[model samples]
Target chain A: MLSTLQDEKQDPRVKRTRSLILNAFMEILPEKGFQSVSVQDITEKAGINRATFYAHFPDKYALLDHSISQMFRQEIEKRMLDACHYSDENLKTLIVTVCEFVSNANSHCKPSSLQFESLVEAQVKNQLQGLLQVWLEQDDSDVDAKTAATAASWAIYGLVLQWSHDKNKKKPSAEKFADQVLPLIAVNLRLAQPA
Target chain B: MLSTLQDEKQDPRVKRTRSLILNAFMEILPEKGFQSVSVQDITEKAGINRATFYAHFPDKYALLDHSISQMFRQEIEKRMLDACHYSDENLKTLIVTVCEFVSNANSHCKPSSLQFESLVEAQVKNQLQGLLQVWLEQDDSDVDAKTAATAASWAIYGLVLQWSHDKNKKKPSAEKFADQVLPLIAVNLRLAQPA
Candidate 1:
């Protein structure tokens, strides 16, 4: 999936429209809750017609999902986690990425609407599962890569979600938190082999 | 959901058959990974007919889901985590319950098969969502209870999943692991309002 995305050849016009729509959505997302953001609003903000918006994303939720997925993918790619095989260090970086993503996502809106949270969850989990599968497939394990990926994806998302919610004045930074939970998460990845 | 379960009245024969089916499933799950455990196997183990098994559950997957849900619920109720509201201590107990549940579930099979992991995940995440919803409803906060509950539920399941996967010879016990993660999990519960 990462390779396909990296090498995709797209018409400049299509890319331009999609980018415009995403930028508009990101701008309005923090101002209006996800549930309140409308297709018309996005179209107006992006200086495009409603039809153009629909051509790119069927609805605002899809736009949100796509945007979040893209932003998160970039984060993963930035850390080079997307191109690497499973390693303790790579896994640690993955955790930090998720932690930062969740914290940043949460802080963007005044109070995160239900629609926003669920969309983010779906997008993040999907990508995490995909990336984990790539790493797992490179190894020979008795357990299925897809299932291991699913479990690990869920676990990584959960750990970051929990870390992002921390309100303690002394709550550890994402790096520290990721370091603390590293051992636990690395275990999920190794579940393909018996101990 | 808990209330519905507690107050339910059922035909004695119906209840008995369901119990028999569940018992048979529990006995067979470890022996035959979740994927290989057929309805025929469950019925033969339970001394019932295939039609009777179908009458209770759609298929082996449903049976696995139902049985795991019941067992995890029992685990929660046993810890009395089900009958409580949001509190740091209760959250700690919830984490402990999940850790124990994951560790014990992983230990049941030689290699935690893909089917086994997925089924356990579905059951655990569902119950965690329900339990977290109960806790969130008792609090007053800016965040939506259901959304908060959903995120928190996923995080808890993921964290425990990671903790259970740890292969370190000196890994912290479930209780100790829960203690370490309690603050992070507890913060998710208190997201609604400042306590």
Candidate 2:
């Protein structure tokens, strides 16, 4: 769902319009949620007409997809994980990032519905798979990159989702939780190694 | 979503009614898919009234949940995997079972929508987590059983999903694929083991 103009070379006007629409959408999301926020609401908040909003996004779901993608990509870049290899330190950082992201998404959204959660999951997992495949390929592991990456991405996401939903008062911090499960997830990528 | 009467002590009449509803659902699912099939459709197909259908299930989603749970449980039991502890062989069998179930679900439903797939996913993953937790706890692993089970269940489901969707002409058989990924998944449960 990446737009061609999503890069730095895009026209200033296009970038500004997209940024305004995204900002307005994000502001309304906490108040009305992804389900209740309408196109008209977003357009009015952004000081843009319906046509301008439509030109930017086909609908709210598409907007959510784009927003989640951008947010998750930034999370990866923030830790410089997008350029990293399959080191233990990098993997632990990735897990922490995911834990923080899922936790933040849950708390930020007014009332995160199942639809919104699944949409975020789909976007995040897609990017996770891509980033993981690159890491696996770069490591020159014997295991099939695509399958291992798929399993690892899902495993990491599932664990963090569980962590985010933990109701226990003594729930561990994200870094602590990631460190506890680090070896478990690491083995999924390098199957030949002794844990 | 398991009914109180979903056991051997259940009344024969209740069992018969539930069976009829489930059978009718299984029959209509392939013809009309999950979304298009309604309570009326199930009732008519089962030669029962809407009230009788409602007596067994609250709605079509609940019916789908119960149906999937039964089917996957039966698959697990058929291999005697439910009665066993964590072993390399049993784990391989579980992965193969998931692959087969996912493949069957995709083919049985006329055009499986995202909603249907996600519903099935939630039900299957819940059961898988329960089963895996039992296995992990029985093995007395030092790792946290709850978190490890959650991760392993999602990993197995995700890998099988990717396998089911493989467009390659020479995609591996379920057994072969399971063998390939067995070590990767096994380590998720027993962190101390050497792969």
Candidate 3:
């Protein structure tokens, strides 16, 4: 996940092309969505050639993955959650952050299309796994960090997506939902309880 | 999904190589799993050079994707579910198929590793979406078939995976579990009422 962010030191032209394509993608997503936006649409909007777009992203899906990952990382860094160790308080904050991020992301996409949701799911789960891996490694746990992280990350992203989709009359607030599911999510980590 | 099966007309040598590599992969998977089985191990096991393995698969993940997709498709065909359209009976069968498949697949690996699980998730979900899309398109519905299929397929795969992971003393059998979740899965398709 960090490799996606470490491209900042690349050739200026490469960086310029990527930013242009990503900016155009963000602009077009609200109007057309992830499914309908073609490579040509992005290149045309970005004022770049189709080949230039291809050089940067294999397809719009790649662009969406990169874009969503960047935005989600930004969300994490904003909350200062990216570098933190695991704690009950931090976990609650992380869950709330994801809830708000998924909710806002869905609302911004106009139709909340499947393509959009799936892209969000992939990117969010990926970053969540990365974050959780770091947190798990910081403590002593016999459970495999990557395994625990993968399970927890997927579970958190799935639950948050479902929570964001809920429209029941008595739907719990995001905080309440997080609190309710916290134990289920925590068990995925299997932390060696600090003696 | 059909394209994966349409490779029969390809060069006999290409078919031979793929089968060899796949056979080696399956053998190693039970011993070392998806994470630890290196490209070299597969090539050496198959009695082919590393270049031969590279020519066939970009990486083990791709191999895993292909291998899992092929096996799961066979499971679908064995049950005669591949060509059928959606019905409650079919849906229930699909759910049970996934539950049993996941359960059996997990049992084959020593640790039920994350890499193994994730690859299975991707391949199964892809096939499910394709099958659901065909079923939804065969009938009229207010819901977008692609969108509904994507949503339903992911939800079904996710729920069945969780179900397979459940070892509670009171957990239902696969058939009973399918019957229980059938309604929840059906609503995602938004099927029109039968006249």
Whole-model Cα lDDT per candidate? 0.73, 0.84, 0.76
Off by over 4 Å in 2: A1-24, A35-60, A192-195, B1-24, B35-62, B192-195
Chain A TM-score, each candidate: 0.87, 0.90, 0.87
The lDDT ranking, best first, is 2, 3, 1
Using TM-score as the measure, what is the rank order of every candidate, best first? 2, 3, 1
Give the winner by lDDT: 2 or 3: 2
Q: Which structure is stronger by TM-score: 1 or 3?
A: 3
Q: How do the residues A1-195 of candidate 2 rate in per-residue lDDT, one tens digit apiece?
A: 233345558788788888888888889999998777899999899888889887878778889988998889989998999987888899999999999888888888968877688888888988999999999889875777887788889999888898899898988999888888887887788773321
Candidate 3 C-alpha error for residue A98, in Å: 7.0
- Put down candidate 2 lDDT per residue, B1-195, tens digits, no spaces: 233434567788887778788888888999999978889999999888899887878789888877888888888988998999988989898999999999999999978977688777888888899999999889865767887788889999888888899999988899988888887787787662321
Of models 1 and 3, which has the larger DockQ?
A: 1
- Candidate 3, residue A192: Cα displacement in angstroms equals 33
TM-score of chain B of each: 0.85, 0.89, 0.90
The order by descending DockQ is 2, 1, 3
Off by over 4 Å in 1: A1-13, A193-195, B1-195
Model 1 TM-score, all chains together: 0.53
lDDT of 1: 0.73
Distance from true position, residue B78, model 3, in Å?
Answer: 1.3
Model 1 Cα lDDT, one tens digit per residue, B119-193: 787678878888888777766556556545655677677667766776779878877776765655555454432
Extract clashing residue pairs from model 3: none
Best by DockQ: 2
Q: How would the docking of model 2 be graded?
A: acceptable
Query: What clash count goes with each model?
Result: 3, 0, 0
Q: What is the lDDT of residue B151 in candidate 2?
A: 83
